[model samples]
Target chain A: MALFLVNVLDGFVTGLLLFMLCSGLTLIFSMMGVLNFAHASFYMLGAYFAYQISLVTGFWAGLLIAPLIVGVIGALIERYGLRRVHKYGHVPELIFTFGLALLIEETVQFFWGKSQLPFSEPAALDFAAFAIAGNAFPAYKVFMIAVAMGIFLTLLYILTKTRIGMTIQAALSYPETVQNLGHNVPLVFMCVFGVGTAMAGLAGVIAGPVLGVFPGMALQLGSIVFVTIVIGGLGSLWGALVASLIIGWLQTFATAYDITAEQVLTAIGFTKPELIWDHPLQDLWTLTLPQLGPILPYLLMIIVLVLRPQGLMGNRES
Target chain B: MNKFNLMMATALAAGLAAGAAVAQEKVRIAFIDPLSGPFATTGTQGLAIYRHSVKELVNEPGALLDGQAEFEMVPFDNKISAKESLIQLQVAMDQGIRIIAQGASSGVANALTEAVAKHNRRNPDDPVIFLNHSAVDPALTNDKCQFWHFRFDANADIKMDALTDDIAANPDIKKVYVIGQDYSFGKAVAAAAQRFLKEKRPDIEIVGNELHPIGKVKDFTPYARKIVGSGADAVITGNWGGDMVGLGKAVMGAGFDKPIYTYYGATSGITAAFGEEGDGIVKLVGAGQVNPAPTPEAQEFIEAFYVSFPDLDFGQPQMANVAPMLAAAINEVGNATDIKAIAYALEGMEYDSIVTGKTVMRESDHQAIQTVTVQGQTPEAAFEYDKSGRGMVAETVVELASNDAPTTCEMKRP
Candidate 1:
């Protein structure tokens, strides 16, 4: 029972962190329909910037400053980089961002070298938050959960209850109409891109210390973030949230459980093969739940894509 | 008669000129490894070590055969892939490079070894040699071993042979968990730990064993929790890169106060992130870097390496073994072009390194049999440049003979 509860908590923590990254990506996709491929690169910048900031001003100062820096950079890229390429159509825009992502990774490697940096959690949050059945929950992980939740609520508040939020939503749905109504649609798009990237940056700032900050950090988290937002829906924020949570639960629970194919096969009235090595399906038989845990999110993503097609909370009829 | 005599004299003159050119020609060894991507850091450091060794050891007077041969490195970036390594090998050989050097991934090493052997079999006259530096998968020196592939570092099973002794002696460890990256090297480590631990300490119970996907795991908190719940007294892992870093953080974050013995826990920017949390908790088993500088020459090499490349962490001067031995072999045969003599000279060569004292090149399998240094990370100032001041102190140093760990190698030498 205790193990179950901790798994739930752990899953939620991971889920919320994924939401923080996917929310920005989904929002950007909704507004500009650009599907910013370099969105995860911005998150990577946040972690590297935070790591650099933490060296001088400590973790708190890094938390505040790094995301802001990323936001400004995101806005600049949208204005100068993405907007210039926008006239060439969506495919070119995607190719441009993909190229930009590669450029960012190389740039990071050039500056930081290819080794994992010594980015560590702050001394303050470096303790056990609590334990369930002798298994200690890290204070830093709890802190990550709290910060993710805080971002979620703050983002929710700004997007749902405010006049600016309504304008942004209108722009996402009917950009031409919004522009015809004297609203700055392009500016709104840039802001959404900036803000979305900032959220990714913020995730990086917090998650970098724990996730292991290196050039590959972006590559590691990049695909999964896409999967999260996709399984949620391209333009649906709520869909993204649901999808992230699902992936988080799937990954954590899958990793937590230990069951082998051999065990399952034996239980199903099948006798064990004496020459396991000689079996044609030896690799399949050798697989356990832990071995398959990392792939669960992708499996879930595939299932969601096939079944729902539009994603869990996605509103498009197509 | 005059015309025939002139033709014979001209042909003899041409042959003499070619022999002289062969004797004076520079020897080029291609440094093929991951010079790009995530594993580039290790490759870069390795390149630095190779450059330094060639300058300070191999090219220096009395190092090479009458200092006549010029040792040069032909750089090729394999990008950490087996296929890319083979491509690089072909490119290098096409450029007249007769020696191929690479050591990052065992998968790549295996491919290179097989490719070199096949090339040797097909060509025979223009065969290249492979000098392995750091990839330590046991099978490379076992069943998959080739006559052309010579590893300078100790293999996985040899290191495990040294490690399990300490684990057996420590009565505090009642139950141990084996966790590693989901790959050949990791599986080998797990299997080794199980076999060696059982053989050494029959009373000790193995609590858990697992293999996580290599470089895919972002967080290891859940895995750490499972380990804690399993009531494990100690942990053994063969994880490297970000996976290793994340695992270390999770272990410390949950405050799992037990030692984590590892094949690669000593590296990958781990100690820097781990501050006080890592001190004495993490252990490593490898060839060199024991505390209190094994010899004056070893200390000098360490100091000189830092002076040359200040940014890099302290690494094994494993290349010292590679360059000096190759030079010695070439010198023994008095000709760099005599491939047979050079390979034969290296078969049972006994080398004395500044770090490990003496490392033997086994005749049966080409794997180096050296003293394994078991070290642990310490916060105190115990050793020189210990992972940017977070020192990896020596715990135990054990040397084994060439026949200590038997190989499955059926070497078919040329």
Candidate 2:
């Protein structure tokens, strides 16, 4: 039971981490109508930057400084790259970002090589938190959860309460109308893009140690963030939250169980024929969600898309 | 016209004709694999090895090039998808490629096999031969075996059959729990291990078996808990890459305190991930601690690999083991640059390798029969070892079946 609780906490922590990436993605998609495929690339950049910065000025400085650098880089891309490609339409913008994503991944490979970086947990939190049912939950996990949760709450407050947040939200509804109302709509878009990318950078800062800042990590997790937003609802922040949490829990819970597809088939009276019993797929049926957790978001997104195109709490149609 | 002017014009025309023929007759061999995307790292390594083997084959002093002796290697990206591989195969054939090499995963390999077979049935004379080097699925040799396809890598059954004898000898290990990646290679290794273990020691029990997805697994605490609580004396796993590292970290961090037996665990990358914690993890593969040192040819390849990649630690790289095997296979193909001759040459061929004394590819299943090495981490720091992490204080080479197990393949020899 204690193990179960630890897993739940782990799931929640992972979910918030997903939220940090997804929140930025959905907001960017909502405002610009183009899914920034390179958002995860920026996250990867943040992790690498943090690693570099941490080597010089410890984890705390990296935690504070890396995301700002990522935010600035993101704003530059929005202003120059995405803005230039925007003239050709949203599809071209999406394509441009996709190209950007691939470039970023290649650049990362060129910089770091094809090996996992030795990103260690902070020295301060380098111990087990609790031993439950003879398993020690590491303190680093709890710290990650706390920081991710803090970031989420802080971002939520800033989005809902601040003047800048109100303007950005209005710009999302009516970009030209807001411009007519004497507000710089382009600047708002740029800022929102910057903030969204910054959130992903924040996720990288925390997730780097655990995820092991690697070259392919951005490509691995980039599509999942899209899945999270799509499953949550295209432009709904609350939907992203639900989807991310659900995905996190689903992955944690799925891997925890030991069940096989053959069992289900056998229960349904499909006994294995000795001739075909030795087939490779006989073992494939044993796979669970945790086994496929990385792709589960896409599966969920597909299911959600088929059933509810608007998403769980989404008002806008995909 | 004058006799002198006519002779000069004829010679110039003949020279121009020969040059055109040389350019047109160049055989294009398509190299399809996941060249981009997440799994491209492995694909890239495979490509590098392929290039090195080809360079060795072509640049060999007495190597023959047959009638035309010219070729172009055109590589296409399959993105690790079976369907995509099939499409790539079709496109490659459409682009006038009569042969291809690659299959980073079994799914792609199997799909390409079917696609190539379908192409053969439709066009008998213009056949495409696929040389698969990386996909280690046993079923590819068994149920899904194709006449046009030939595998170079040691199959899952060969690897498991090798490890079973050593495991059977260890009476201390009575209970075994299997944990593997949720994929064809992983499942095949686990199932093969289970079958062989049951065959040798009927009394030994498989306590619990679990399959986790590849690349998706992060925190393996729950999986580790299950394995630890199962009271298994030893655990066998077939996980690799980030999943392998993550699982090891989880097992160590959660204090799963059991010796982990693995097919690919004692990997160089695993050492990087777990550091000294990776000590005592046992891995089963063809090449480990290439003792008796290596042949002059093998030493040349090893030295070249190191010189090319100085940043990478030359310790337990799986590529170092697999690359030499691949090179030997290419060598045996013998002046056969096209797929058909290469396939025929590879089947039922034996070669003296640095690691394995006499590795043979069985005629019946086209599966490579070779020795397997059991590697354990050395406690003594700065221990001497071979490239595959064997020859240390604690390492053993175990022999398994000398041929591929009875397969249901009806591949008629051409």
Candidate 3:
């Protein structure tokens, strides 16, 4: 039971971190009608920027300034690069972002080199906030949870309660109508893209210390972020949150348990085959839950895609 | 004008002939490893170490026999894929490079060994010799051994033997957990750990054994929780690179204060990532001591290497021996072209390694036998790694004689 609780907390932390990335991605996709392939790269830039800034001005200053820098760069890319490619259609936009991702990764490697940076959690949050089952959950994880929740609530408030949020949503489906009302639709799109990328950057700033900042970090989490947004519903923030948490719990619980196919087979009254090592189904018999932990998210995504083309909370079909 | 043209043609002809002569005296070794992708750091570091080693051990005056031959490493990025490695091997061979050196992945190593073996059988007149520096899968030197391939690093089974011996001496470590990347080398390490521990310390119980995907895991906290829940007193893993660093962080973060035994706990940004947090908790079994140099000459060599590449420590001690040993074989045969003669010369060869003392190339399996040391991170270490202020200090030394494991290789000589 104690172990289960630890898994829950760990899973929550993992889920929130995913949400931090997915939230921005979903917003960009919804507002621009173009899926940004380089969203995770923005997150990576956040970490690297924070690392550099932290070296000079400390972690707090990096946390604030790094995301703003990312936001500015993102706005520039939207204005110059993505805006030009937008006329050619979604495929071109995707191709542009994809190329941008590779370029950013190379640029990062050029600057930081291909090694794990010694970026660690600040000394202030070094101690364990609490312990369960003899396991200490660091205060840094709690901070991550708080930041993610704050972003979620603030995003929810802006989207539902604010006039600018309503205008942004109005522009999403009826850009002509919103532009006729004297609102700069192109500028809105650029700002939304910038803000979306800045959120990803914020995720990276907090995650870099925990994940061990490196050049390959974006690649590691890139596919998974897509999976989360896809499974949650392409443009649904709520879907992103639910799917992220589901993935987090699924992976953590799968790893925590040692359930094997052999046990399941035995429970169903199947006898163990003699010389099982030579059997055709030997691999199946030896397969364990933990071994499948990393692939569980993809498996879930496949199941969701097959059953419901639209995500659980998403209104539109992907 | 006609006289000037004739003089230029003669000069060009003479220069071409001299260039051909110099090229003949140069032996080029194709370094097939990942130069891009996530594992690029390890590969790049290995290449740098090899280049530096050649500069000091083979290129320096009186290093090789008569200094008649110069060794060069021509790099071909395999992208850490077996298929790509095979392609690189073909490209290297096409360039008339006879010697192949690689060691980042055992899967890649296995592919190259098979490819080299087939290439040798089909093209005996033009064969390639593989020089493995750091891939430690036991099968490469055991059932899957090839006469054309040579391993400089100790195999997984031997390192496990040394590790298990250290664990056996510690009475407090009764319950142990084994985790590794789900691959040939990782499986070999886990299997060896289980077998060696059972043989040496029968009373110890293996509480948990798990295999996670190599380089795919983003968070190891769940795995760490499992270990903590398993009630294991100690943990053993053969993880390296980012995986090692991630595991170390998760384990330490989870508050499992017990010692974690590893095959590669130090170097490659791992030591730096762990920093003061891993001091006294993380331990590694490897070839030679790093903090306190094995010999005075090795100390000088390490110091010089640091001066050249300040960010990198002299991590792979086996790399220091690769060029010198290859040069010895080349000089003995008086030529680098005869692959068979060089193979025979390298067989049963004994050389004094500045880093690991006396080392022997075992004739039966073409595996190098050298002293192994079990070290732990400490601030008292003579040399700090990655500016971490903590370095690996040797806690125990297992000499070359006792560090031998029986090989199942059946040599098929040409």
Candidate 4:
């Protein structure tokens, strides 16, 4: 039971990290009508920026300043780069961000080399907060959960309660109508992009220490961020949250357990076949839980897609 | 005033041209390796070693070749791809470069080896010799050996032979967990470790063996937890790069206090990545040590290299011999451009490496037989300075490798 509880908390922490990235991405997709494929690259920039800042001023200063710097850079790119690409059509806009992602990865490699940096967790949070069943849960993990929760709540309050939130919702469906009502639609888009990227940057700064600050971090987390947004359904922040949590829990739990295909076959009343290597489904028989851990999220995504065309919290269209 | 400056520049250019005209002609070795991309630092480090060797051994008047040969090292970026390496090979051939020095990825090395062997068979008159400095996959020396591909470093099995010998002697490591990247090299390491440990210490139990996809997993926390939970006394891995960093951090973070044995660690930013977490806990098996150099020349080379390239360290000190040996081979053949003769000459060659004393190139498999060291990171106070400002110290140094491993190379020599 203690192990289960620990796993639950771990899954929650991982889920919240994913949510921190997806919430901004879902918002950007809703407002701009073009998928920002470079979203995870923004996450990468956040980590690198924080790492550099931490080197000079320590982790606290990095926490306070890195995302703001990322926000400004993101705003500039949206204003100058993406704004020009927007007029060409969504295809071109998608292509632009895709190209931007590649450019950012190369630029990062050019500067940082292809190695993980020594951007470790602060010394204060280095010890275990608690131990369950003889296994200690790290204090840094508690800190991660706290930050993720804070970001989730702040995002919830802003998107649901604020006047800008209402404006953003209105702009999502009727950009022309919002512009007709005397609001600067282009300014709104730029603000959304900047804020979304800043959110991603915040995720990067905090998670960088835990996830490791490396050139490959972006590539590792890039597709998963998109998967979160997709499986949660586009334009639905609530859906993104749900999908992130589900995928996170699924992955963590899958890794926590040690189930093998042989167990399933035996449970189904099938006799174990000797010389499994000679069997037709040898790979299937040899597969185990830890090996399947990374794939569990995608398996969940497949199930979700087949069951509901719209995600759990996604909108039902005509 | 402008005309005078222009005339002075022209005169300087002419003087250099006249000096070059009187100088000896060169034997070019096309370095078809990564000059840019993720592996650029490694490639550039190798290129530096080659350049240093040329300056000290080949270019100097009283050189190893005795000024009979002036070898030029040309750079070509393979981008660390097999296909790209073949493309660069063609480009090198087009430019009339007959010797290729490449090492970084075993994948790229294999591609270059096969391509060169085919080139030798198809176009014997224009054969290109390959000198591999690193890439330690055993199959390259075993089943997949080629006449043209000669490796300067010992193979994976040889390194494992020394490592398992040391590990078996350590009574503390009764339980070992094996984890590596899910690729050919990683699998080979895992298999080799299991085979070697079973042979050396039959009582040592392999508690767990896991293979994660190369560069795919973000966090290795789950893997670390499993290692910790398994009650394993030690861990062995063949992971490198970001994967190594992530795994090492997670393992150390989880408070798994035992030593983690690795094939590629203690250098290439890993020491930096480990920081204080790896003072003595993370151990590695490799060719040489950076500090406490065995010879004065090597010590001078290390000092000068660090002074010039402060950001990089000589990861594989065996690479120091890459150019020297190539020069010796050219001298042996009495002709620098005689590719086949040079290839044959490289066979069974012996040299006293500054790092490892006596190193031999095995004639049968083209695998260099040399002393290997197992070392761990030490504080900066222990050594003056390393690339990470903290150098490594050797735990075990095998004077001569016990390389009794058999090979399947049935070479049809031309």
Best by lDDT: 3
Fraction of native Cα-Cα interface contacts (under 8 Å, chains A and B) also present in model 2: 0.34
Model 3: fraction of the reference interface contacts it also forms: 0.77
Ranking by TM-score: 3, 1, 4, 2
B331-364, model 3: which lDDT tens digit per residue?
8898778888999999999999998778899999
Better candidate number, 2 or 3, judged by TM-score: 3
Model 4 Cα lDDT, one tens digit per residue, A125-219: 88889866656678988998898888878878987899988887888888899999998989989999999999899899988877888777777
Residue-wise C-alpha lDDT for candidate 1, range A1-318, written one tens digit per residue: 898898899889889989999999999988888888898899999999999999899999999999999999999999999999998999999999999999999999888877777777788987778888887887888898888888878878888999899999898788899999999988998899899999999999988888878898888888999888879988887888888999998898889899899899888988877898999888878889988988888888899888998888888776
lDDT of 4 by residue, B1-414 (tens): 999999999999999999877666688888877887667767888888777767765677445456755878899999999999999999999999888888898999988889999988999787888889899998888788988889888778888888887789899889999999988999899999999999999999999887887887777776777788788988999998778888988788777878888877766667877877788788778776555676787787777666666666667778888778887887887877778888888899998777766888888888888888877677842343224567677788886685566788876677
Candidate 2, overall lDDT? 0.71
Rank ordering of all candidates by DockQ, starting from the highest: 3, 1, 4, 2
* Candidate 2 clash pair list: A291-B213
Candidate 4: which docking quality band?
medium
Span of 10 residues, lowest total lDDT, candidate 1 chain B: B379-388
Each candidate's DockQ score against the native complex? 0.72, 0.30, 0.73, 0.51
lDDT of 2 by residue, B1-414 (tens): 699899999999999999887653454568888877655656666566555544544333323343234335688999988888878888987887777777577888888888887887787667787767657787887888877777766677766766666678888888988888876777787788889898999888999776776776655766776776667877777776677767777776666655676665543345555555556654445443432333566556546655665443333322333334433444566443444556676677775555454667677877666555656655442322223233222256654344636887777655
What TM-score, to 2 decimals, does candidate 1 have? 0.94
Pairs that collide in candidate 1 are: A232-A239
Every model's TM-score on chain B: 0.91, 0.80, 0.94, 0.93
State the number of backbone clashes in model 2: 1
Candidate 2, residues A236-301: lDDT per residue as tens digits? 888888999998888776766655566667888987656565777754654444455556667888
